[model samples]
Target chain A: MNDSAIDQKPQTNSIISGAQLLIHLLEEQGVTHVAGIPGGANLPMYDALTSSSIKHVLARHEQGAGFIAQGMARVSGEAHVCFASSGPGATNLVTAVADAKMDSIPLIAITGQVSQTMIGTDAFQEIDTFGLMLPITKHNWLVRSAEELLEVIPHAFEVALSGRPGPVSIDIPKDVQNELINFRPKSIDSTDVKAPCSALDENDIREMLAIIKNAHKPILMIGGGIIYSDACDDLKVFAETLDIPAVQTFMGLGVLSNEHPLSLGMLGMHGAPFTNLVLEECDLVVGLGVRFDDRATGKVSDFCPRAKFVHVDIDRSEIDKVISSMYSIHADVGDVLRAANNSLQHVTRPLWRQRIEKLKESHPLRLDGDDDLFRPYGAIKTIASMVDDSANITTDVGQHQMWVAQAYPFTRPRQWISSGGLGTMGFGLPTAIGMALAQPDITTLCFSGDGSFMMNIQELATLAEENLNVKVIILNNNHLGLVRQQQTLFYKKNLSAVKFQQGVDFAMAAKSMGVNGMNLGQVDNPHKQLTKALREPGPWVIDIPISETEMVFPMVAPGGSNRDMIHGEEQ
Target chain B: MSNENQSLLKLIVNNHPGVLSHICGLFARRSYNLEGVMIRPIAGSSSHKSCVWLLVNEVEKLPQLIRQTEKLIDVITVEQHDMKESIFEKTEQFFI
Candidate 1:
């Protein structure tokens, strides 16, 4: 497996192929696995991979390989690598790459192009992969020469894993991989990225200190930015020190331990009623590394109207894009949180804590009335109870997505992954696939809605094809629950195309896809089914048919204040 | 939606070819700007509606606008809704 014979770099010694450098570079970057299919143009790279220590997973399709890499990233919270030959192979990886772009997963997709001589002449399998992937990736480059391959291969990995992680591509010409080069591993020096001197400048820190010291009621809204910036430890320390209630964004579900008294559950459309109520009353709102998306804000103007906003994020563009902030800081979440922790005084928002406690006591997350447990809320609670603190959970977008965010008690940061920016439909299944592929040893869960499941249900075949051990929990409500809920609240009793005429047999579908599937009902004993499915040999899907009329309650009316949640209509 | 102060129109269609383009081009060709538009799968129904709420300073042109849109082959019906005051009402419920 040693390709050291190809490592000769002396000009007179021998002309080594560039593909040899690619293989060595991947190895140097700690790549232990590559998911791809070899083709004529990529034969050299494939040969190198086969002879190297890195194991190769032959995906059924190019897109499946990309999804596998994405799954790897989701599970390991690290860069996952994939490879494909040019033309159709490169194009096929687009959807998964786009998915990665939307959800900010770090993936390295290496594409093989025709030899340099045939690149411009439209040879078979020739493709302008760099041009094709430009709009979708964080950065993309084509290896023009064998020497360039050395720089681009490792750089692609670095860029993919750095700064709010995203997909990056390196297109290598066939001839380049065949060329030889001497390889040397060196640490990347990034002086250009100057660290912020402190979480806040003296003036802003003083102002924030004054606000926290003087305020009797303050709440902290944490977002995925904390996870992205690796600020969980600092955030936990700061929250505990100040005794501030930290409410998480849907993407920030596991940022704070769910059991913490000051940890308010997710706050938004599907947020805990108590969290929204407390947000409405807080005198000060310190948002950490979270974008105030419309879903989180409900109605932008009415969001936290009574609260004075202090926003901190690495990306300044997100600070005032939705809600105006009385004070703002643009820095890394970890850096800012660390600085804040250092400067934070002996001040506790006791009144705020009391008020939040009272809100929690007043309106907990619950299904309407003494209704039987046909609700997804109880199911979500049960799942959360069963999953460990570090379980990697992905969810499909919809009412169920919000419900998972609100109900699940996450104990570790970045333990949850769901579509956030684009609210993409098919994100759950593929993302779960990626997570499972990434963390082969850990248990990964994909919670999806029947409506959302249909969006990318085809990936179940890919799941089976890859023999990935991931579990899926389908919240089958037989409707586009979120849209249905919105229409119910505003569309004057007009519910169209939102109902399912016939029941969905997910177990049948799973079996057909060559995987294990189980259907669970409220009346049926699910403990055995749950344990068996969780311990199953391969991918498992649990179909839980929740009531079709079920609605995610504690909803803040559009453009209404967070406190203005319209409870179920009076009978 | 109401009968008075109409500003919104729900145009049902057979989900046929060129329907979306025809409706959009009709609006563009007529120089009419839409306030908002929402299209979703009709519940329990096998049809799609391009529900549009138009904002205009000239109320007299509303009827002609609807008439023109209804002439499309795919459009089954055009129902104008009372959306003048409902603009803020609908917006206040979600995106605002």
Candidate 2:
């Protein structure tokens, strides 16, 4: 059937199977694409999808599908859906869903369960998906009947998108999918179903302003919430108007342009010496849309010990989860920032700014060998120079990821995408595919280490088939660099199990998967080859080799205060 | 059974298959101590709603835990009451 023929078919007040109804409901929610692979359980939903307009991208694994959905949702700032079968398929999606939950990305995972009657009978492809997803999701549902899809589908989107946006899951039994029912299709507007934000307290804004007025050395600590709530513009204005420097958490990297004078790069564990030092001296810490994660707040008690912290987040539970706040505002961070911006005075502590400038000059982030393209920092900077600010950058969890975070000059919100809270190694490739799928006009760069790349290397086939404008640059070090670094620094140099004895040739592997591959190691002029590969790209994997001895520096020992950072040269 | 160290929490929540699990799961995952729990449908009220009364310790984390519980989709309202007002106190004789 063609598009017009499907459009002509009667959609409302007609008898349809539960699976068909689910497709129609998803269509109503404005979902355009879904990523998943059909299996024994979820085949019915896939079968129904053939008649609908939704395009399904078949992922090599359920984990890839979940991360693909995450990529779309993380970039678009809306809830995107992924599907999976029961048992192993559902289990495979756990990591991605948990990653989404940790990062507060809005995602929906729908899984097919065994027939309702055979739930506890140990039937084929059976698992308690509802129970598995309960702890990870914002909310979840196990559909008992076809009729419940009407309420569950919309509520799933609502729960996933509302408040502190996070992943949600739905488990549909096979019997429910096959169950026939008369569905009166109502035009459910996606906007209408969104829950309204609670009214912000005026007094909270008043108190925030009063605190800002008294503090001599104040710093604005921002996070992903600023990007999610679309408060980046407000934050910029507020920080500039007050002449206060702002420090970003890992997830909040692109909220302020890296070149912004008030922008003090990322703070906490892997933060620059100046950024962490400035945070240490601050008399007041205004945390906006930040959860104060341990990675960003090493030794919670000792972090900003002199600062009176004020936290603003949409979720109240996060206010005192790690560090107690002097004042907590439970509302959208955008709402709080907008309110504070209105009443906040134009004040500047020139003395404090001078102090911060002095620290920046004295203890700067050392970028050794940054002029050489083969080096980590140099490779990242060269890549950033190749792509415009519009391009999206993603990285797998390792030293390569930290290198990208440190060197990539991000200018706009939502430009930097990575697994911050969960630090999943295989997140880079699939997420870049999703980003490319959502916004095909711009380039999507996936910077992965050899260890991290091998984890989801199978997704290269999906990338080749989709023909997305994604460039995968594997910084092949032939070892788990971060783990090796730790072993070298802390564990008496007994480097065991961190190195791959025999490395797989990534360039040849990419070619076998039908993607264009280039190995910089084999080329005489790697810079020229890299330039050519990045310029002409549908899907290309460029293997760039770096030494394993390179480590992400300015590190804080686990459980140590951020102020006492272990420098690279010290090791 | 009423003691200074304990507090009673009264929660009005949606009576559903997963609502109880959602509440109990929060307690278990967050490591909040739950001494006792009593739940039943409200008399002469809508069948879809139920009242759950819980006896819990750790008064310092009570306020934070209450906020977390309220964030659950099924939980409607959570109210803190003194141990003297505990519903479990009156029914202690039956269990004993």
iRMS (Å) per candidate: 20.2, 2.6
Candidate 2 structure quality by residue, lDDT tens digits, A202-318:
998998888888899999999999999999999998999999899999999999999999999999888999999998889999999999999999998899989999899888888
TM-score of chain A of 1: 0.86
Task: Please give the range of 10 consecutive residues that has the lowest summed lDDT in model 2 chain A.
Answer: A1-10
Model 1 reaches what TM-score against the true structure? 0.75
Candidate 1 lDDT over residue span A1-571, tens digit each: 4533333322433445577667767787888878787887788888666557778877667876887787777656788898898999999888778878766778899999988889789888777787677667766777778876756676677667665677888888887777665544445554422232234476766677677776667889998878877888888899888888888887788888888877887888767788888877878889898878777888777777778888887655466656778888877778777877777766666666677778788888775432333467777767766666667788888988877776677788767787787677767887787777667777788889999888667778878877877899998988988889888888976998888788678988999998788888742668667877776668998998787777777787776667677776532
Candidate 2, residue A364: lDDT: 96
Instruction: Write down the lDDT that model 2 would get.
Output: 0.89
| lDDT of every model, 2 decimals | 0.74, 0.89
Q: Give the TM-score of candidate 2.
A: 0.97
Q: What is the interface RMSD of candidate 2, in Å?
A: 2.6
